[model samples]
Target: MRAILVLLIIVVLVAIAAIALGFVNVSQTRTASLPTISVKGGSAPAFNVQTANVSVGVENHVVQTPTVDVKKP
Candidate 1:
């Protein structure tokens, strides 16, 4: 029993330490830089595109009553 209790305490302590470390990691602030790309002038053909309008409809229906029951002893 004593050994079991000690093991449980150690497990709990480890869990707490892990949670604290997670909090520390989450609270940290880091910075990062990203590269940029530029395009130069090039001979390209001009094209025209046409788009059509689309209609969408959604409907939902409930078929049965939902209920929850709790019992006490």
Candidate 2:
């Protein structure tokens, strides 16, 4: 039991270290001119997004569901 506990602790620590190092991205900031829109009647428009970062993750998961089959007697 103690050995299992120590192995679990080590695994957790390694996972923490890996996560801390993996987030060190070298993404530099660069400005690009995006298209600006102006309303016809000079009314203040609003936008929602302030600082948005989009990441897509794909994971394969298997789920098993039980099904019941009925037979006519």
Local distance difference test, per candidate? 0.87, 0.85
Off by over 4 Å in 1: 23-73
**Candidate 2: tens digits of C-alpha lDDT, residues 1-73:** 9999999999999888877899534565997888998768666788898887999999999999999999999
Which runs in model 2 stand beyond 4 Å of their true positions? 23-73
Best candidate according to lDDT: 1
> Each candidate's root-mean-square deviation in Å?
14.1, 22.8
Provide the global lDDT of candidate 2 against the true structure. Answer: 0.85
- What would the TM-scores of all predictions be? 0.31, 0.31
Error of 1 at 46 (Å): 94
Among all windows of 10 consecutive residues in model 1, the one with the lowest summed lDDT is: 23-32
* Candidate 2 positional error at 24, Å: 10
Q: Tens digits of per-residue lDDT for model 1 on 1-73?
A: 9999999999999888988888534455788779898989999899999999899999999799889999998
